[model samples]
Target: MNRKATALDVAKRAGVSRSAVSLVLNGRGDGNVAKESQDRIRLAAQELNYSPNAIALSLRNQRSRIIGILSDEVVVSPFDGNIIGGADDVARSRGFVTVVMDTERDTARDASAIETLLDRQVDGLMYVTVGLKPFEVPQGMLRVPSILANCYDEHPEPQLHHVIPDEVKGGREATEHLLQLGHEDIALLAGAAESPAAPLRVQGYREAHVAAGFEAREDRIFMAGWDIDAGFHGAMKLLDDVSPANRPTAIMCANDRLAIGVALAAGRLGLSIPADLSVMGYDDETRIADTMVPALTTMALPLREIGRAAMTTLLDSIEGNTAEAETTVETMVPCRLVVRESTGPAPTR
Candidate 1:
């Protein structure tokens, strides 16, 4: 095997002292190291392809330079992608790397994953679950500064930092958008009860209607699943069972998939989008939203932003003394509605 280049080789090629090469490459040089000398060292290092030993550096720095990640739902949903990407971006800038293990949505698996990350000697760790169900933190992780992003809290006392979308705000904003387009009879096709987001979203729907001084119709509120199939069936029942006057002028499906399902069902009934019925959605998953016939007018849940915030919090906790405090934080990033061809002025009889 070919041998790797070392600092001594770099110094020899640059005609400089090994100390000079080390100081310039490590960015720890004082004024005694001339800019011209530094340039020569860099050029030599590049020419020889002298790579620093990360393991040796880690030992010297007393760090693994690796951030460990645990996710509850990376199989069925891509939400964890945003969190990981956000964290990775920050980690790279700080010369850190990441390691991840999926918990497969099981609590036992979650605990085991944490243990694995711990065994790997990660500088810090993050554990993420999809809902508000009180998840027990990986035992003994109380000593690490951890943060949760884009999901609700399981821990009531919440000893660590948490970042999540403001579901109530997201829900109310979605409803208000429909109302702005002159929709009074708006319906909520919600997610399953397992979704902690469901009840908060329902609350937002109600608050919006109340703000408009229109009593929200209980019949119009449907607790459905988050999938397209659920929306398909729910929209059918809502459309078929209600009186013409009582039928929803607009519908807010829980997520983009559900909204697309609503559109498909409405289309099957020969109902014109925006003219016969308007539909709105949440999560704003672009894969489905951008391709819809009229395109989807949906509420964006700030998934990427959730990832960004969680990363910032994790880095801070990893590098700062703040991690040692008993502080608990809840940050609700803003959400907005994107109006597309799907919504319009209410149809007149």
Candidate 2:
């Protein structure tokens, strides 16, 4: 095996003292070492293919360059990975690494995982939730900097910086699309009824109905889990209620997974998409949206960006620079509409 070249070798080859070579190579020799000697050291290093050890550099700075991510849910949806992916991109670019853990959606376990990260002395922490329930943080452990993703703590006062999709806006936009296509009697296939996200999105749908002089009928809204099976069952219930001839022309599902179920249920009822009913979903998951019989029309969330923002903001807060006051720093990013074959003008003229 070839011996790795050291600073001493470079110095000897350059006809200079090892100390002089060290100073010049480290970029700390400015005005202290001769310019000619600096140039010689650089050339010697290049010829010897010398490279500094990154692990040693990190050790010197007392940094592992790793951040910790605490979560209560593993996969909320395809968007779940997206948010975390976005955060990873930002963190890696900044020379940081991330370690993620989940507590299976339990608040107590979520808090415990966070405490573990603190014990590990991570540079920063990101707390993520799949649903709307607030994952409690330790009131006493204020030293750990944490940013929230896809969930909020609902603190009566400002306690953490958070980044999540603007569900209300996404809900309104999906409903408005259906309404624009002349679907006034649209149904909302929502996630869990108690989800904070659910209520906000329902409000947006209400706003759209109100704008069109529609009553936003209570009977039209159905609550279901964020899964294809849930949507399928919920759609079946709606299918059982009315004859296909008189049923609502559109369904706005809470997320893509649910929308898939809706489509499957409609098929079982012998209904053709966009001909008998127009369907839309949120949190566009590629596997569900692109692979469906008719590609699903849905909304896109910047999940990855939310992840990155969580990492960065938490780091900032941990460093003692609190995020902008309680109101100004809204890390919530809005969702974008992704029109596809799944949605279209209502069956009605």
Candidate 3:
């Protein structure tokens, strides 16, 4: 069996002292070692396939160079996987590795997951969420430089850093687009009331109406789950019980799934999308949104960007580069409006 090459092998091949090779490789040889000797050492190390011991180097530097990620069910969701991908990409580019764990949204498992990552000597931590929700920053996580992604702490400590989507702007943009198309009578199919995204979106919806010089009808808004079923049911209530004169000209769904449901409901009622009624959704849900029959016009949340920003913040904190005097800092990434075929000019009665 071939033995692994050592620093001594590199030094021997370069005809230099082992210490000289070490100094050159560790970036301290500029003035101490002759330029010719440093070049020889580098070439010899490459030829010998010799590399420094990461463990020993880390011990000496007091840094593990590993970032720990804890998520609440993000690992299992196809749509949410971008968060992990983004974080991993940035960590790798910065010469760090990532260790990921999914807590499955079980608070009971958070402590153990965090403890295990801590035991691994991770230099920093990132807490990610599959959806926008208010969470409690785990107490144990405070031991390391940490950041939250796509989620925020309801009552944050000064040390917490968060990167989340600007749902309010996204909501307003979606509604404003419909309004610009001459639709003043619009219905909102909102997501779960408990979700942090829900209220922010509602606020934006109201803001858009106010800006357009129209008072949104309170009865036109329906709160429901962030799913196709809730959207279907909500649409039924909005379209079935109301007379045609009272029916909204457009429906703004909190998510693509709900928008799809509204489309289906519209079809059942013999209404053509954008011709009889326009529909808009949030969270472009690329996989579904663009493929729908009419294609959904929606707001695209910058999920992957949020993940990357969170990692960047955590790395800054780990390196003592943050300038904030407070313990917590919040950052919001804005969503973009994705125009598609589902939305159009309001139908003339």
Per-residue error (Å), model 1, residue 225: 1.6
**Superior by TM-score: candidate 2 or candidate 3:** 3
Question: lDDT per prediction?
Answer: 0.78, 0.76, 0.86
**Which runs in model 3 stand beyond 4 Å of their true positions?**
1-60, 156-158, 241-243, 324-328
For all predicted structures, in order, the TM-scores are 0.80, 0.77, 0.83
Against the true structure, candidate 1 reaches a TM-score of 0.80
Report the lDDT of model 3 for residue 218. 86
Mind giving the per-residue lDDT tens digits that candidate 3 earns over 1-349?
Answer: 9999998999999999999987777545667799999999889988988877767767876999899999999987767778888888887645578999998778899989999999999998888988887778778788988888987877834457788999999889999999999998999998998887888999999999999999988888878888898888888888886777789999999999999899999988888998989999998796799999899999998988888888877776776556667555789899999999999999887
Instruction: Assess candidate 2 and give its TM-score to the true structure.
Output: 0.77
Stretch of 10 with least lDDT, candidate 1: 319-328
> What lDDT score goes with residue 150 in model 2?
78
Residue 324, candidate 3: alpha-carbon lDDT: 63
Clashes counted in candidate 1 amount to 1
RMSD of each: 5.9, 7.4, 6.3
The predicted structure with the larger TM-score, 1 or 3, is 3
